[model samples]
Structures are given as structure tokens and as C-alpha cells.
Target: MILYYALLIIDPSLIGIFINPFIVQFTIFTRVYFIACLLGVLIPGILFAIRSIKSDKPEINLQGKLLLIAFISFTIGALLTSSIPQMTIKVIARLILVTSSLEFYMGYLLPNWVKKILLKNDN
Candidate 1:
């Protein structure tokens, strides 16, 4: 978890800005949109970590405002970017979002079928 958040911090600040020169050329609106996307990932990760560290329990209602913000940011970023590489990165980011969101869901949401599969021995 620490590694994940560390990457989140590092990616946008150090790697994204430095590695992608076009990012520096982006308008302020675009910059804010990207920042919002980063916040989307970071906020949920922070909340999940805090809740886990405190009680080792899952948090229901995992899909909240942050996830929606992340989704919208990604959509806008993809639409605005003309570069194929940037578009590819957005695609990868989307995959990461889905994977992490699934982690949150399975951990906290506990839908009945998933619970049955995970707790087959429990009555």
C-alpha cells in the first residue's frame, strides 16, 4: 500500500511532469483536470489505508465522488490529448482505476455472491 501511494505521488510530480514535455505545455485548465484525476486516485487510496490501519475493516460505499472525478478526468484528458502515447497512458490509467476500484469493492462492498465465494465455510 505504501508502495502504491508512493508511486501515485511520484508519478504525477516527478515522472509525468518530467517525462512528458507536452504536459508542461498544457493549459491551466488541462493541468487542473489532470490534478483532479490524480486526486481521485490518491484520495480513495488514502481513505482506504486509514480505515484499514485503524480497524482492519472494509469501507462500504467505496465508489464515491472521487471515483467519479477520476473517471471524468480520464475521459476529458483522453479527448483532449492528440498524442497516441498519451492516449495509451490514459488507457493504462483506466485499467489501474478499474483494478484498484475492484480491490476496494471486494474488500468493503461484500456483495452476496462474492461473500459466498469467499466465505464458503461460514454458515
Candidate 2:
């Protein structure tokens, strides 16, 4: 998704050619770009929640919690965007920061605890 966004930025003219009628002005492209970015951020939250639900292991519940946090943060950021000028940049920055933090937590912090729990359960 990020790669797609990059492509859009690099060649807006090429992209516009595919969907020419919809993108009359630069503002429309900007709006579409932002919307795509928002959806890209959202996909992981939804996927994580679904994975958490499907997995029987109770230890996998962290994904659901992260999803909730993501949703709440997104709502708050959206509200702030409406009230503040130049909020899109702030919101995007916040999203990236939060996403990276969550990825780190999942990659590093969760692994040790998950291993410990699985090992304990095995015994």
C-alpha cells in the first residue's frame, strides 16, 4: 500500500490517465491520496482483530487490544483534524509513529512473553 502511494506521487499523470474523469484537479488527487493512506493504515487493525478472533490461543489476544487502541487513536486524530489547521500532516506523522511502536512491541516485547507462556503451558 505504501508502495502504491509512492507510485501515485511519482506519476500522478499516469494514475490520472487511468481514472481521468474523477481527478479533474490537484485537490481531488490530494483527497484521494489521503483517503488511500487512511485505508492503508486501517487494514492492519482490521486484519489483526480478525486473526485474534480466529486463533483459539488466548495468548494471541494482544492483537485485539491493539486494534481497539488503533481505532480510538484514529478517531481522536480525525476529530483533531477537523478542529486544527495543517492537521493532516500531524495525523499522518502520529499514525506512522504509533504503527512503528506497535510493530516494535509485537516484534520484540511480545515474543519473550509469548515464549514464556507457551513453554509454561507445555509443562
Candidate 3:
């Protein structure tokens, strides 16, 4: 999911300044975007990372936003990322959608389609 969002967030204003003046107050926006990306990476690992955080205590499993956590992990896991806030948001949104689509496909549609095909052949 995070991978989906990160890829979707390509820089739109790279063509030319005249073509797109969307970049304003460049420094602050850039920082926020960086933070968002960092969050994307950290949110996931931190969740599962606790499985071994305390050796003496029982494992504490996490249960929450699957996609959001995945996206955070994806963005953080990336080796490099652009500082563009808008672009980062684009990627994050897309990642969430893609993750949901994948969940749907895997849990319901894929199995049903396969079963339907087999049943049709039997008929």
C-alpha cells in the first residue's frame, strides 16, 4: 500500500516553472512532505516491531489501519524520496486505494472467479 502511494506521488511541477507554479513557500512544504514520508515508513515497522521489543513480556500484537500502516512503512523503507508534499500525498492516497483493491481481490473476487470457472467447466 505504501509502495502504491509512493509511486503515485511523482513530481508534477518538474516540467517548468511557467507550466506549474504550484510550488509556494517551498521550504516549509518540503519539510512537511518529508515528515509525511517518514511517518509512512515508521508507522508500519513500529507496529510489528513490538513483537520482540520486550524479551521478558508476552508479544503484543498490533491491530489497526492496515493500509495506513503499510504506506508509512513503505515510504520509510524507501532508499530515497522527493521533498514535494503534494507528490507525497498523491502517492499515499494511491497506495491506500491499491491496498484496498488488493485486499478485496485476494479475499473475495479471486477465489470466487476461480471457483466459477471450475464450476462452469464441470457444467
Candidate with maximal lDDT: 2
Candidate 2: which stretches are off by over 4 Å? Answer: 1-26, 71-83, 86-100, 107-123
Reference-based TM-score of each model: 0.37, 0.43, 0.25
> What are the per-model C-alpha RMSD values against the true structure?
12.0, 8.8, 12.5
Q: Write the number of the candidate with greater TM-score, choosing between 2 and 3.
A: 2
lDDT of 1 by residue, 40-95 (tens): 76666566545554653222333333344444444444444523346466566556
Ranking by TM-score: 2, 1, 3
Name the regions of candidate 3 deviating beyond 4 angstroms: 1-25, 28-49, 52-71, 74-93, 96-123
Ranking by lDDT: 2, 1, 3
Candidate 2 lDDT by residue in tens digits, 1-123:
565567678886533343233223334555466566667766776676667746666556654555555554664564344323454555675675576566546533467764564334644
What would you estimate as the lDDT of candidate 1? Answer: 0.49
Q: Which consecutive 10 residues in model 3 have the weakest lDDT in total?
A: 57-66
lDDT of each: 0.49, 0.54, 0.42
Query: What are the runs in model 1 whose C-alpha is more than 4 Å off?
Result: 1-26, 56-84, 116-123
Q: 72-96, model 3: which lDDT tens digit per residue?
A: 4455433222333365654665565
Identify the candidate with maximal TM-score: 2
